[model samples]
Target: MEMSSKLLEKAVSEMAHLPGIGRRTALRLVLHLLRQPQGQTESLADALLEFRTQIRQCKECHNISDAACCEICSSPKRDRSMVCVVEDIRDVMAIENTGHYRGLYHVLGGKISPMEGMGPHDLTIGSLVSKVKEGEIRELIFALSATMEGDTTNFYIYRQLEGLPVKLSTIARGIPVGDELEYADEVTLGRSIVQRIPFEGSLKG
Candidate 1:
């Protein structure tokens, strides 16, 4: 349905394209923005533009950052010896929110999904392997989703690390099967981290 007002229609359509937003909700948001002081809306637009252009992946951990390395990677306070492997930046945020981890992270970028045609080559697994082999790393924590692809990815990484000096562990399965790490609450996520278990699976690959 084409909206009669061109500017309003454009705003609503763009908002609709964003995740979890519908045309009606977008219209409401636009109206709210319009009602605010000009400074508010203008600053918001500028900030959005800045975020789009300024953010990049961290060189070491692949987390989102405004510089070459994210705060986590550069921070001396974080524990580099314990590296946590996550599927994406959202998982990093979720874990950080829990305040349960002081270690570094390696973003796989995505999981190994054969049906979706995503594979190990498409991820940063090779970089993770290289990072682990660099030594001084004590534990490699797998904090991916509990989905089938997530399991496949975990098993694959586990096999790759066999006989390596690093110990392989995983966040507890308290996170429901099919649930993403990004959605788990801080308490649950914290508990899971505190109760992580070692990988007992035999790597087929």
Candidate 2:
């Protein structure tokens, strides 16, 4: 808990703020970095700084990218008509790892969690509605986590798209209830995507 150097203390403090990292782990990481060559540490700092400063959100799907549009959104090989709705970039990465889906994505940024003060306006739902309105998207696949918040967010979007011509579907419940898509194994996630069911059917019981 006590560091001999104030600089080391500061470094550990900042590192501990990262998700899943505790003060002990942060101190260990800081010590490891100190033991590394000076250039390597500098390179890491530079990379983090550049990533924080230069990363952009894809203009179409809100995925983190190096430019205005992400590679998936801009790729002609992707099926633009099939848009998979996910909670964030992590979910996109998870689905991409499965390699079962060739469709484009729309990152909702976050779910509607009242306890966390995350609502529809706090997310990219408006643009998603606009995309559906454009009629270019023929199918919308809900790939959100199986938690209550995820279902709430999905139902909200379903209501918004009522009467729209787009085919609505959700990933099959191959994933355990309340599990995050990002945490599911590639095979299960792939099967879920490949064997998706109609949204209306998922709502019944």
Candidate 3:
């Protein structure tokens, strides 16, 4: 069946490519955007373009930033001695939204999954090891998910950093297995921060 205008169809098609958006929702959103002022449309386009043109990865932590280094990495108030290791940029935002953490972060960019052709070499694992070894950091917290892939990645990093100067720890167990950090409630995430445990073999309790 023939649909609406080519422009409307185009917008919906593009939106449908996003993670959770479907054709029906995308069409509704396109219609909603169509009713907005032309300036609003222009602003959206500009913002989309600017996302890449303006933002870049932080050299130190590998997080997204408008500058070479993210504000978190440059902030003196942030605990340079503490570094939270996460799988992706989204996890960084999830943790930052809680406002319960005061340390810096190191985004691995992805988990270690041989099935998907992602391995330790593909992530920032080496950088993390080097960072912990420099003696500038003290704690390395694994805040990735509880899924199999998340566990694999965590184990990979933990083993490599076992002999480093920093303390290796994992978030508390209340998160429940198979849960993604992005979907975790802030209260649970905050509580986990307080009760994180030392990584296996880190030190005798």
Q: Which of 2 and 3 is the better model by lDDT? A: 2
**Per-residue C-alpha lDDT of model 1 across residues 1-205, encoded as one tens digit per residue:** 5688999998899889999998889999998999899999899899999999999989999999999999999999999899999999999999999887999999999999989899999999999999889997999999998788998999999988888999888876666667999999887788777876565642211
In model 1, the number of clashes is 0
Each model's TM-score? Answer: 0.81, 0.84, 0.80
Each model's number of backbone clashes? 0, 0, 0
Candidate 3: regions farther than 4 A off: 175-205
Our model 3 lands, by Cα RMSD against the true structure, at: 6.9
Residue 43's C-alpha lDDT in candidate 3? 94
lDDT by residue (14-120, candidate 2, tens digit) is: 99999999999999999999899999989999999999999999999999999899999999999999999999999999999988899999999999999999989
Residue pairs with backbone overlap in model 3: none
State in Å the error of residue 127, model 1.
0.5
- Return whichever of 1 and 3 wins on TM-score: 1
In terms of lDDT, model 3 sits at 0.87
